[model samples]
Target: MADEEYISVEEVASIMGLSVRQASRYAAKVRTERINQRVLFHRDDVMEQARLKGIEHEARERAATYQPKPTKTDLVPAGEMLEYIRERDRQLAEVQAQLNQALLEIGRLQGQLTDHQQIRQQLTDIQSERDELKQAMERARPWWRRILGHD
Candidate 1:
């Protein structure tokens, strides 16, 4: 056993693998002492509480070993990752080409629409001129031809 001196709440929590507040809650169920203007719990009392909770050995074993988790770059192979990137780039290029082709088609359709509208306006003007020429020709025919519905 260690000395019978009072231990800090932080130290007890560290040994028991608990947060300070949680350890304080458990420490309240055991013996504690005030030292140097601070409340302190006994090491034996906290350790006894931890043992009763069945986590004392687990905390000690975790503190003994050190192993890091594997990262993404460590889990995947470099050659396979490069092939995936190439496939993604090829798909992106295909989509971009389709978009450019669609834009060009839209421009061509817009030009045809403009030409169609101009042709419609020209046809309207020609119809109005033909009606005027027919009226003038009828007036020159001395109004008798118009009554007969002829030129």
Candidate 2:
């Protein structure tokens, strides 16, 4: 077989049917370190290690029973907390400003809609007044003339 190059921890896990953490531990046992936070393993080294560890039933059993411990870090200082709060407040203020602008635009549009409605109502009133004027003019005409005008 040809010499294989480097492979990622996830790739190794897929090949060995193991989890990424298990692959990481295997890589670490072989003194394989990550480069720039990217974990890579030599395929030959990984396969050799897997073959050697394959017959070790005790190691496999231990690995299956292993559990990672949780870590606790110190909380942020009061000053740092205040700074975070200030940053959050600034972001909220910016969002509120945008919301206010949107509301103002909505109000302007509503006013424009009201103006259009008022214009439409005025047009309807004008048409009614024109109709009434026509009716009044017809009524004021003499009855004999009105009868002849239609002919």
Candidate 3:
């Protein structure tokens, strides 16, 4: 086959409006290149296949009038995008402030709990000391003798 006569499977598929597999099947000859390891098919065979399938005219018509869909990045202006970013930053700052306040409240509650625990331990110790003193006094003298100040 002549060098100018052969076309890649991808180009054949695009021109004939068919998948690469379908184009490969329809093409007359599949050529393999050793240098780049590329596959190519005959252009005339692809065109003949499209004509036989009665889609050649339709494919050309579609290709002539095709328009790509617009994307968000293309439609949005730069100033509005900047404003959206600023609004997001403001919301983030507000959330951060709330988190800090919650942390401070947790610390204060923990300190109060520690203080209450210490007071409870001191009360327990005082009760035990009072009981010991009462036992000593009772062992030394009877109740009536203690009331009369006699040992």
Candidate 1 local lDDT, 50-104, one digit each (tens): 7898987876564344244466789879999999999999999999999999999
Best candidate, lDDT-wise?
1
lDDT tens readout by residue for model 3, 44-117: 56556667779878656644554544667888889999999999999999999999999999999999999999
Q: Judging by lDDT, tell me the better candidate of 1 and 2.
A: 1
In model 1, which residue pairs have backbone atoms overlapping below 3 Å? Answer: none
Per TM-score, the best of the predicted structures is 3
TM-score on alpha carbons, each prediction: 0.48, 0.42, 0.52
- In terms of lDDT, the poorest run of 10 residues in model 3 is 26-35
The per-model lDDT (C-alpha) reads: 0.76, 0.73, 0.73
Looking at model 3, the pairs that clash are none
Candidate 3 wrongly placed segments (more than 4 Å): 1-65, 141-151
The TM-score obtained by model 2 is: 0.42
Rank order by lDDT, top first? Answer: 1, 3, 2
Write down the TM-score for model 3. Answer: 0.52
Worst 10 residues of 2 by lDDT: 65-74
